[model samples]
Target: MSRQFAILGLGYFGSTVARELKRHQNQVLGVDRDETRVDALSDMLDHAVIADLTDENALKELSLEAYDAVVIDVDDDLETSVICTLHVKELGAKEIWAKAHSDAHYKLLKRLGADRVIYPEYDVGVRVAESLNYHAMVDFIRLGERQFIVELVTTQRLVDNCASVANLSIDRDALFLVAIKRGQEVIRNPADDTPLQPDDSLILMGDLQALREIGRQI
Candidate 1:
């Protein structure tokens, strides 16, 4: 289903979101203070406006209630981001997603009624560090503060598919397989009984330490 999305700020992060949302067949409205940026994305987005998102009164002039989702990617402008979120909520925006520069900013975003807060720099840095350390680890996602979901390439040295996995001695209560990515295709929500093939990438969600331990053996 298509969604109506409004993106405030046309900076790097906001522009990227706008493009992706449009690519997903969402009707996107992009607002930014920079004229050049507004012009740049004008052809891509359904509507592109050069406006100050910080101005609550001006923002009120916009039909915020019409958008199903609002994304505030205004980086470094904590005050503006907060005000925009608040005003958007007041205008009946169903979902609000914001970008945070730091812990304090993240807390403020939550207080301002942001449904989701993204720490792009911090998140990207962590993923990059994880991939650098583990050659088998393709990517990592945080499911909770203490838990992570990781995608890793399975070793090709296994004699038997089922036997190799059974010998791993994984604690089913604490850790388990979630999916198998064979080549470019991903198998959704795979079961433990699913046979592992050489060169298959397994996606596992569990405690970070447990994932690391499993990665070492694989």
Candidate 2:
């Protein structure tokens, strides 16, 4: 279903988000103080305009309450960032996602009623570092502070001698095998006797420490 959204900045991060939202068929209003940035993304968004988000009166004119959510991405200007967050909150925006550049900025955004605080650079850096550290890790999702669901390819070390799921000897308390992807086929709740191929993808869930241990071993 299509939803209404408003992006309150037009920098690299903001423009990228606006374009992706529009690509997913959402109605996006892209606002920015920079006319050049606004014009550059005008063709991609539902409405692109040059507006100063720091001015509550100017923001009120946008009728932010009507949009399903608003994203505040003026991280370059810390004061403007928090001010916009406050304005959107007061304007009755249902959901607010704000970018924070530092720990203090995150706390301020949270105290000011931002529904979610995003640290784009930190998020990307962590994912990249994890991929580099875990050679077999394909992707992963953090479920909580210490828990994660990871996808890993069966490495040569684990596939030796035509091993099967029964040969894994995984610690039940640490990790649970959820599924296996062999070529185009996906095996959910796979049997212990299921044959493991060298290139098969394993979907497993466990604590991060346990996952990291397995990642290092295979």
Candidate 3:
């Protein structure tokens, strides 16, 4: 189903989200104090407005409460970001996602009622480090404090060693093979009989340490 989103502060991060959401056929309203930024995205979003998000009257004009979700992405100006987030929350936006520059900013946003706080730089850094550490790890999603869903690219050595899911033995208490992706095909909840192939991608859910151990063995 399509959803309506209001993105405040049309900087790089906010504009990117607006464009992608618009591309996906969702209704997106892009707001920015800079006319140039709003104009640049005018053709892409459902509505592009040049307004100060921190101003309650300006926010009221947008009828932000009708938006299913609102994203606050004001960079550099932490005050503006927090104020915008608080205003959006008061406007009754169902979900609010805010970008935080630091730990303190993150906590403040959370306290202001941001449903999700994103630390883009830190997250990207962690992903880069993971990919660098494990050459075969394509991506990872943190499910909890210690659990993660990891996507690892299979190697010829791994395929030769483990012919099928049943052939690979690991601590089930710590790791679980969730799925396998080969080319465009995705095998979800693959059975033990599922054959392993070189260059295939394995999606596994498990503890971080256990995942690291599996990465080494593979």
Candidate 4:
């Protein structure tokens, strides 16, 4: 389903979000104080405007309440970001997402009624660290506080020890095999008798500690 969104900053992060949202067939309105930035994304977004988002009056002129969501992406200036978020919230925008540069900024945004706060750099850093720590882990997705869905490549040790899915012995209470990927073939919810092959990609969902334990053996 398509939704309407207004982005209050046209910096790299905000522009990227606008483009991606537009690509998904959503209507996106890009706003920025910098004319150059607004002009650069005019063709990419459904609408582009050069306006001072920090000015509550200017923000009110945009009819922000009509937008399904509003994104405040002024991480460079904490005060401007906070003011813009407050204005959007006061205008009764259905949802507000704000970018935070620090813990203090994050808390402020939440207090001003932001529905979501994003720390892009911090999140990317955590993902990179996870990949570096787990050599066999191809990708990782956080499912909850202590649970994750991890894509791992089967190792020689794993194949030699288990041989088949049924014979595999791990923490059944915490680990569950979700799927197996062999080249172009994907076996979803694979049967217990499924044969194991070294280097095959396995998708597993389980607790973080259990996954890490299995990671060590595999």
Candidate 5:
């Protein structure tokens, strides 16, 4: 289903979100203080406007309550970022997502009614570090604060040595073997005796520490 989104600030992060949302068939409104930045993406978004984010009257004119969600990305200017978030919240925005530059900023946004506070730089850095540390981990999604669902590719050596899932030294209770993927086929709820295959991708979910220990083996 298509949803309406208002993106305040047409900088890199904001513009990227606006473009991607528009690509996914969502109605995106891009607003920025800089005319040049707004113009750059005007053709791509449903509506692109140049306006001061700190002005409550200017924000009210956008009819923010109509949007399914409003995203604020003017993190460079603390005052503008906070005021935009406050204005959006006050204007009855259904959902508010704000980008925070630091820990303090994150807490402040939450207090001001931002539904989601994101630290893009910090998140990307952590994911990059995890990928570098795990050779076989293709990708992963963090669940809450402690759990994770990870994807690990099988190697020829793993198939030869472990031979089957039963032979794998995995903490059965700590980690749940979600499935195994081989090309286009997906083996869901694979049994303990399931034979291992070279180049198969294993999907596991559980504690990050336990998953990390097994990721090393993968």
Candidate 6:
């Protein structure tokens, strides 16, 4: 299935997203204020246009509502990003994902009606730190204040072959195996008898400290 997306702003962040979305077989429309940048991405994106997203009339003319998702990646101009986000929301876009330069920007974008806000710089730094320390930890997703869902490689010492709560002792305030990600297959709510493979990536959900302790033990 192919989803249509519109990317506002064609800076490094927006251009990268546009290219990747097109690579994944999605119809991507990239908008930018710079004609040179737009031309550079013309071959890479499904459609590339030079336009100012901050202008309500320009954004409305683009038919942004047609896109399943709209990504706002304007960092140089925060006001423009906020205006674009509001315009997209009012246009009835199914989803709008925006990028923020700081905490203030993030809050403003969220308030302006962006469905999701991403701080790429901060998020990348966190992921890089996790990857450097725990090579087995492939990814980390925030669940709550102190909770997280981590993707970790299963070890040989695990009692069971399948990822489940039976093999590992989880504290009352700690973590538990949520699922097993094996290759492209995901086994959710696996039974205790489920055998885990070393190649399997276990999706553990619970306290961050407990997950870290288990990772260290392995």
The local distance difference test score of each candidate is 0.83, 0.90, 0.91, 0.90, 0.91, 0.84
The 10-residue segment with the lowest total lDDT in model 6: 158-167
Error of 5 at 40 (Å): 1.3
- The sequence of per-residue lDDT tens digits that candidate 1 reaches over residues 1-218 is 99899999889999999999999999999999889999999999999998999787778777887889889988688788888888888888888889999989999889878899999888898888887887778888888987988988877654253444456556677787887788788887775456677788888889878888877766
| Candidate 3: C-alpha RMSD after superposition | 1.2
Score every model by TM-score.
0.88, 0.91, 0.96, 0.90, 0.92, 0.80
Rate residue 196 of model 4 by lDDT.
Answer: 96
Tens digits of per-residue lDDT for model 6, 90-208: 98888999999988999998888888899988899999998788778889999789888998887776534325456666564677778888889999987777776776887888987
lDDT of 2: 0.90
Worst 10 residues of 4 by lDDT: 121-130
Off by over 4 Å in 3: none
Residue-level lDDT of model 5, residues 89-199, one tens digit each, is: 999999999999988899999999999998987888888898899878788988879899999999888888888888887898889999999899999989989998988
Q: What CA root-mean-square deviation does each model show from the true structure?
A: 2.5, 1.8, 1.2, 1.9, 1.6, 3.4
Would you list the rank order by TM-score, best first? 3, 5, 2, 4, 1, 6
On lDDT, the candidate that comes out on top is 3
Cα lDDT tens digits, model 4, 1-218, are 99999999989999999999999999999999999999999988889999998898888889999999898898489989988988889889999999999888888899989999998777788878877888898988887899999999999989999899987766889999999999999999999989999999989999999999878877
Best by TM-score: 3
When 5 and 6 are scored with TM-score, the better candidate is 5
Instruction: State the TM-score for model 4.
Output: 0.90
TM-score of the candidate numbered 5?
0.92
Compute the lDDT of residue 30 as modeled in candidate 4: 96
Error of 5 at 47 (Å): 1.2
Clashes of each: 0, 0, 0, 0, 0, 5
Give the range of the ten consecutive residues with the poorest summed lDDT in model 2: 161-170
